[model samples]
Target: MNVTETKRKVEINDLYKLSTAYDAQLSPDGKSAVYVVRKINEETAQYVSNLYVVDLETKEERQWTFGEHLHQTPTFSPDGAMLAFVSNRTKTNQIYLLPVNGGEAKQLTFFHKGASNPIWSPDGNMLLCSAGVKSGETIHTKEEQNEKKELQPLVVDRLIYKADGRGFIKDTYSQIALIHIDSGESVQLTQGDHSYAASCWSPDGTAVVYSANLSDDPDAVFTSDLYVYNIDSKETVNLTTGQGSFGRASWSPDGSYLAFLGSQEENQTVTTTKIWLYDFSAQKMHCITQEWDVDVEDVGVGDLHSWRRNPGLIWTADSEGFYFLMSDQGNVGVYHGTVEGELTPVLFENLHVYDLSVHSNGQQAVVGISTPTLPGELYTLNLTSGDREQITHLHDTFLDDVVLAGAESFTIKASDGWDLQCWLMKPAGYEEGEKYPLILEIHGGPHMMYGNTFVHEFQTLTASGYGVLYINPRGSKGYGQVFADAVRGDYGGKDYQDLMDAVDYVIREYDFVDEMRLGVTGGSYGGFMTNWIVGQTDRFKAAVTQRSISNWISFYGVSDIGYFFTEREIKSDLYDNIEALWKHSPLRLADKVNTPLLILHGELDYRCPIEQGEQLFNALKRKGKETRFIRFPEATHDLSRSGDPKLRLDRLTYIRDWFHQYV
Candidate 1:
């Protein structure tokens, strides 16, 4: 037998062995590249990340930092003599600098609220950083208050006070600061109740551009504006009007243009994000990708690559064009565009490009890619010739002895004749005539597309003798604007039909999929659909709802983004249109559910609060239905993807065991 026939199947513990490389940064001369490698510590049940550097000429790699804590975002200085990164080894994340020659890394900043997102200055003498500071506070303020052992009541004054990962908000605001490399002194540049994120520095180092919402009541408005802060004059100029959301600003080499990514429509969640250019001489802004139908951002969803960073927009050295990642047709790839509204594909492929770093010459770039069988790796691409060379072997050894199932892509017509993209993964070591159970996987973001990326969850299920089916229904990105907005008012209308059509198509075409042993599961919006599916039909033998929404009335107040997200996505509000909200809620039809459901939720998930799971479980129990509830403590909405390692494994085990019992 061949080596592939003798390989072992993937297991739940394989998550600890997978290493992901991200946040790639190329040096000024393009001789060396630095990226981050992240892996889980099986003993500690926590994540550990370190910096690694690879030489382009020799293709030799070496670890740059070693620690049990997290280290990320490695940026090279202008001279390429030193590297700056962020680490939490000192109890809080702070900037640290290391000389390329050799020595111990030195701490650069001591902000009490912590500092991150380091941007090197043009002259290489200073670093632009971001830190959280409360009102009337400076960057040098030291922590003096003792740790509280008792709980204190929180005072809420803003609609956007609480967040999913960060929990209850303190009055802290993220502000920009400057740190002197030699003197180790820090100066706060921006202040107020508002927060600011520094994007880039001008070529001459005279001004810096940042994004912030400066409205009197920022909670009421969802627009962000870019401003240029002049260093010597201490003056600020608003480059963008307060009508749209814009960020990720990149200055041209010639210093005559500024490029950014954003949408002109404020508070519209379904609108496509476009690329815009600001002309310095003309003092006007124009949309470059307005005619392009694709979304100018990476929107591919997967479980393996968490904390993946986007390169945003990288400018050419000649200031003639730029490079960016765009999502289209269930794939994210690199595209080149010029200042004169010219666009072309450079490296469009069947893989997801999650991170990118362009060389100063603009002819080469380093990208982090993930596919159906590959978790993640870094590759150097020749921008002109479209040639790729793998530079990282983080997963080569581990994958050699494993058998992974590849996804088969196809298109199916929905009931309304809308073409939808879908993928199916058969069980590993499958036979032609044998039947296997099938599981339908739904992605969150109802706005995010499920593309060609490695998902550990899907691999584990397939390894356990189950087929997996995933589809990009209406209201998902990578399609046009209208398709993405189709399910706004009609939550369970066409989107539901499209999903059902996909399942029917797979079962009819592939006789190996057992129609009687079907299962369904999803999180967030997908979770809501799982609940809806069980209530609408008894076809599915088992169902799993994760971080789901059952009642829109309570969700509108409890969820972090519920207040506005409900109004935008549901097209209704708690005060004016209570009936419309109730009409689309899955809890309204909870009495009709017949499938055995397993509800999973995080205790600290403020995005889709735990109450959503509680209400669904309670309703199903009152009806004397078959159901179970599993709650994870200290976990957020991303429990399946980025939660604690042990908890993530336990979740997968529970999901597999539940399906094994019922399906």
Candidate 2:
């Protein structure tokens, strides 16, 4: 068979062939750009990331780094002569400098605990990064020496001791470290029990600003304040005074103003992120987007696994205006804001901008965008004229050969009269009047919205001859704060009705849906809804729930954020409102569920512990309800997204086969 003539449906393994691009950083002159590209190596069953550079004028893209190194966080030096990035080829992640003109990369620092987040000073001679150090050890001591000690028992003394991906909390604190590019010498800048969350340098390079929560009970406070550290005097100045959960500080070009993103805890877990500015001359702080009514930062949803953090503020050369990505109405757009609190749309459209970098001149930008049909790619946009040109085509050949379904967006009224945004994607290669099975997909964060972004899981279901239906129900972001906050106290109330109404609208409008063969699935918050839906109704023929929460009473003290999350979302307490907590728990209603459900969970998931899944499974099995449980070993709560590559493919296969047999 000829290569182009052979047409095959998207298999579970095709995920390895797809590559993701993100985190674009433009050079000083605006003629070149560097970004991160990630692809799976099937032979090793690991994902590898490397830096790629492109000529903005000619639109030529080429890989800059090679070999087994997993390169990321690429940033150009202040003089644009060298590019610094973090790689893990030496068993631990460390910063490496690569000449812009093309030469062998040189490793900069060899810290004991590794290094990350390299920030260039104004002079480009010294670099600033953070590393974790032990309580009684300096940066020169080897962490491996302590690891070789006789198996000593771990003694826990703090309220927060363990994390999901990082395991148990050891006696290590992340302190800022300064490295000289010329001498390759590393010096510890700050020391204490607390860790610096993030940092940036001033224009003069004499002071470094960072955010940290230095309270006595840091874990219980849920607050971080900005602090400035002087290089010569080694003195520190508190900036924000521990007012809010603030970080991601950016310095203005003239060193007169500092900007950061944060929000006051109005609804706690449902608070919206906004931008705040601090003035050096007036020594005052103010909220710049207090009236914008939009969530600042990229909360866009996509099926691909992404580890890219939010970028710093893209300040203009004149330091009068800045650009950022904010979540709004089913899409993330880049917006421009003035230092005086004026906001305007710079690149508003139906798309998801994961990360971006603006030119120093503020005339153009390199953005990482993903839409419904595009997996992910890079584009250069003219800030002045609003013109966009594609820069990378990583999956062009594969996409052209395969037939895919496009999402059709629509709006409907919820049971409570609120407008709801929903989408339906027909099965690939659908014929007129041909009925197909349907799957209703829900997103993880009940706070996260399903919008104009590429969803690989949904596409896999579509390729398997199923129509996919998704909706931005109440409690989903992209709507106003009121709508997103409505589902806090009401878990299965209006939000449940909104999902059912979405299904009804689709069945009434589209005649190609097989109403009897309906399937449903979701993860995290969506998983809770799936558990709730199965208990409330027997309409869904089959269902799959991943990383779900079943019992709130036990969950209060078990999960990582269970203590505060229960207080905020469920509005209940273990000591005071045990009955109320049980009332909202899905395990309480497990006896009512008759739908065939396949419980998928990660054994190492601390957010919604594996015990939650076990409890639900045992409840259903004891009641003679059809249920099966499958657990992925050594996987975290993000198993579906960032887990082992082989395990992810197996999960897709399991999902497809379960629906195929039951639906």
Candidate 3:
């Protein structure tokens, strides 16, 4: 018998035992690779990450750093002698240098606001990093900022004044700076009211290419332009005409071309992101993936993976082609693309490739992948021979002792004749003829796709005798642009029918599913759908809506992304179409809800603020509907994914208990 058969099912606290490996980086010489592994410290209820290096030739792994703090963004020097990374070991994030041979790591930056995204210069004598600084404030030590602690009222004037995880936006802007590695001396590069990101030094180390919005009214404009900043002359030149949002600029190996991923639609959120290349010699820019209908970024949604960075475009030695990640048909995979618009599959599979790094020759690559059974691990891929090998066994032993339900993928036509990809996970100990409770899970980001990735919550639900069902509905990504943008302006219309059709198909096809004991739960956009579903039909016995929006009229003014997202999604503003917004709101149909609904929300979630949940709860209470509200204090929109460890466990417990009681 299999060891998993003798072992136990997955528990809620099993989250603490899981480990995630991401941010894989290949050495310059391609002999070895380094990555970061993160795990939860149960005592502190926080995540601690450490750097690890593995020899490609010997297949031996060694731990490079040890601590309770985060050590991420590990990049090797030009000559592959030392590694530069960002760490918060001193209570503030700063740049640190470690020698590959052997020695104590050295601290490099002392900016008061903290520094991140460390990039080594080509000559290895300097490092380019980013830190926050007020327009008129000079660089100061951390001690100076600690001395001032006066409470002041925040004054807001910009249109984009706040964010979800981050609170009120201050006057500080993220600026780029150059730090000399030997003396630790720093010089501010680009400084103004605007912010810069995805900055990298030119091959010759004389200039930098970065993404920023330098328009007059940056708050109102949604365009991100690429600019080149010269170090010696202190002059800036605009690369892109500022028609769209672009970033992740990467220079080719020969420094003749620049490749990046972006969308040309100014403020539209559903436009497909494509790869664009800039020719330095010709001073021209063109889209490389114009014919391809896939999004050039990872859109897979999962709770366990945290801090997964996008490895934009890794160039080959020839500078004529590069490798990139694309989301298509419910999976994110690596694809090879050339400047002439030829795209080939490099490692396309039914998995999530979250991070990637390629060798100088481009024949080998290190990819971070995750599946339904595996949380996350690093794998080495041979580009030429198409051979793949798992280099890290982080969860092998843990998985051997746990019975994880495998997902079965299928395609079904929606009510509107659209093909929808769906997955079903049977209960852990499902018998052939035994009827099991079914739970339909919805994903957030109405545009984000749910693929064959590991979700701890789904596993726990299946372990508790509930069959889990999930689908990438009409509004989800990984499909073409039309499918992703279809749900816009019609939230509860066709999208609602698509979800209902999925439930109907599953119940009719699978005799083991208990249709009468059905449950539905989703967060954000999924939360909205759950509320809408319960209000529309009484088929579901229990429903849980998390960080949901009930009233679009109020959501427009309350949520951080409410004003723009409402206009873009609902295609209506308060002044023009109040009735349309109200028609789509779940609270408008509160009197029709009969399901035992549980509302969960994060108090500090600005994206879908807590007020949205309170409004629904009050509406349901006024109508005497079966509803209960639970609020997590000090938690943000990221509560389900990267929140406090204890809170995450409590959340999973609450979800499981609610379903067990009602379903």
| Model 2 C-alpha lDDT per residue in residues 170-208, reported as the tens digit of each score | 878888889999998888987878888656898899999
Q: Among these predicted structures, which one has the highest lDDT? A: 1
lDDT of 3 by residue, 142-226 (tens): 4454576988898888878888897876888888888888888999887778888846778788888889988999857888999
Candidate 3, residue 537: the lDDT equals: 98
Per-residue lDDT of model 1, residues 1-663, tens digit only: 778798999999999989889999998889889999999988898999999999999999989999798999899999999999999999899999999878999999999989999998899999999998977888888887878767778888899998999987778899999998999988889999999999999999988999999999887788899999998899999999885999999999899999998998732998899999999999999898888888999999999777887678899889999999999998999999999989999989899998889986889999988999999899999999999999999898789989999999999999889999999999998999999999999999889999989999999999999999999999999998988989898898889999999999999999999999999999999999999899899999999899999999899999999988999999999889999989999999889999999999999999999999999999999999999999999989999989989989989998999999999
- The segments of candidate 2 whose C-alpha lies over 4 angstroms from its true place after superposition are 1-7, 145-150
Ranking by lDDT: 1, 3, 2
TM-score between candidate 1 and the true structure: 0.99
Give the Å shift of residue 530 in candidate 3. Answer: 0.9
Instruction: Provide the overall lDDT of each model, using Cα atoms, as 2-decimal numbers.
Output: 0.93, 0.87, 0.90
In model 3, where do residues sit more than 4 Å from their true spots?
1-4, 140-148
